[model samples]
Target: MKKRSFADLFFLLFVVYIVLPVVATMLYAFAGKWNKTILPEGWTLKWLATLFQDTAFIQAFGRSVLLSGGAVIIALLAIVPAIFVIVLYFPKYEKWIQAAVVMVYSFPGVILAVGLIRVYSQFGVPMIVVVLGAYVIGILPYIYQGTRNSLRNVDARQLLDAAQLLGASKMQAFRKVLLPTVYPGLFAGALLSFSVLFGEFVLINLVVGSRFETVQIYLMKKLSTSGHIASAVVFIYIVLMGILTFIIAKLTKQAKGATNV
Candidate 1:
């Protein structure tokens, strides 16, 4: 009974810690003028209206979408097939793939930005292109995990062999049979990767700041100019992340249900 009480109290504190800032930020966005009191003196949608009216914010948001969406597509095209081959045929090579995924965690945003700049800067390619490439590699873990997990439940080898025995080519077998079976897990991974890249600020800012302003870069600029606007930006970002998280949960649950069958 005592332990349960302590646990409940601990969780209440944790909830407050996590939720207080978000609530405050949301309040500030709608706040006409909040100063020194428990709540805003007045509330208005002026900040949100002002934010939407900004052309720079719209462009920055688009750039973020392009960068993140492009990376996820490129990763899907490149990594998904490789992982499918690895998991279905050469399971021995999976350890190597796992090692590469582990190495991705070792490179933080700062280190990753610096490393990519060093290697690619000399080649005279566009910095944004370089950033896009890094984004693909950055999301490998998600792509690998999702694809690999989806493939794990099914007897992929036997399924493929049976498909081939029925006079289908390997490519045909993969496209028709394997791809559909593992799609939920793959979709989950893709969404996870997109959400992660969408919020990425460090690498892009460091690589090409003013030259290519993402939503994150725009938010940084707003920080010095207006607290209300910044709060609106953060609130929007949090809401977006929450939405993605919900979708990812639903997809993951669906994948598990499929696996059980």
Candidate 2:
């Protein structure tokens, strides 16, 4: 009884700590005036309305979506197959792949941005391309883990061998048998990657700045203008992330179900 009471108290405190700020921010986004009050003085949607009406915000939102989606697509097309081949045919090289994934996080974003600028700017390469490449590499850990976990959950070797024995070529076996098994996990990873890159600021700011304003860049600009608008941006960002998280959870559950079957 005592332990249960303690657990309840702890859970309440945890919820308050994490949720209070978010709740306050949401209120402020629609609040007419919230100063010195536990409750908002009045509510209005002008902040959100203004945010949507801003062409810059809309463009930045689109750029963020495109950049994140493009990176995930590229990663899925390139990294997934490479990992699949390495896992099935060249198990010994998996260690090298793991090392590379770890290296994704080894360098700070600022350092990476500076190095990319030095190497690519000298050749007159487009800064957008450089940032896109970095975004792809930045998502390696999420994609690699999702793909690796999915592969591990099934007897990939046996499935591939069985498919081959049934007169399927290697490529056919992989495409028809293995890919479907891992699709849910890959999709989840892609969504996760998109969510991460959507909010990325430091690398994009240093590498491209206003040349390619993402949602985060736009949010930074809004902070000095009005607190309400900034709070609206945060609320919208939170909603976007929440939707992606819901999809990821659903996909993960479906993946587990498919693996079990």
Per-residue lDDT of 45-96 in model 1, one digit per residue for the tens?
9999999999998899899989999999999999999998888778999999
Candidate 1's C-alpha runs over 4 A off are none
lDDT (C-alpha, whole model) for all candidates? 0.92, 0.94
Q: Candidate 2's error at 88, in angstroms?
A: 0.7
lDDT, candidate 2, 1-261, per-residue tens:
999999999999999999999999888899997888889989999999999999999999999999999999999999888999899889999999899988998999999999999999989989999999999999999999999989988999999999999999999998999999988988998899999999999999999999999999999999999989999999999999999999999999999999995
Which residue segments of model 2 deviate by more than 4 Å?
Answer: 1-10
- TM-score for all models, in order of appearance: 0.95, 0.95
| lDDT winner | 2
